[model samples]
Target: MPRYLISFEKGAMDHIPEEDFPEVGKTSHAVIQEAKDAGVFLFGGGLRYDDGDVEHAVVGTDGVVTDGPYPESKELIGGVMIVDVPTREAALEWAAKIAVACRCAQDIRKFMYDPDLIE
Candidate 1:
């Protein structure tokens, strides 16, 4: 099995009305539950960047920490889900369901295999 990362970039859902967030949350959670029941979900969560209170730090090779994301990043991940499945098609299927639920396009990428990581 391989793990695929399904994520949506920040601001992707900005067009959605604030009052609809609860419904969005409900639909997204339902999709998450479906994935969990299918035994494919590994972990998922939304990032907290809208609050302005979020602390950003970047650690350098010199062991010094600097503020903020990489200087080149123009966007941030809004939410992400990891699913371990047997094939890319299965991952795409899940991503499609998630996209519908979250009302945002999803970006999917397969994780490279590592011997030390649990399969």
Candidate 2:
């Protein structure tokens, strides 16, 4: 089995009206619950911003810590879901369901295999 990351970038849902957030949340949670019931969900959550500001920090090779994300970043991950599935097609199917629920497109990537990480 491989773990796939399904994520959407920040501002991806900006076009959605604020009043519709509750409905969006409801639908998205339903998808998550479905994944959970299927035993494919590992972890998932939406990032939180403080007063419309993202709270982040970057660390340098010299062990220096800088406030905020990388200066060159144009997009930030708004939400993410990790699922352990047997195939890429299964991951794609889940991502499609998530996209409809969130009303935003999702990016999917397979995690590299690591023997030590495998249970």
Best by TM-score: 2
Model 2 misplacement above 4 A:
51-54
TM-score of each: 0.91, 0.93
Worst 10 residues of 1 by lDDT: 49-58
Residue pairs in collision within model 2: none
Report the C-alpha lDDT of model 2 over 23-61, residue by residue, as the tens digit. Answer: 999999999999999999999999886567647777889
Cα misplacement distance, residue 102 of candidate 1 (Å) = 0.6
* Whole-model lDDT values for every prediction: 0.92, 0.94
Candidate 1 off by > 4 Å: none
Model 1 C-alpha lDDT per residue in residues 8-109, reported as the tens digit of each score: 998899989999999999999999999999999999999887577644677889999777776965678889999999999999999999999999999999
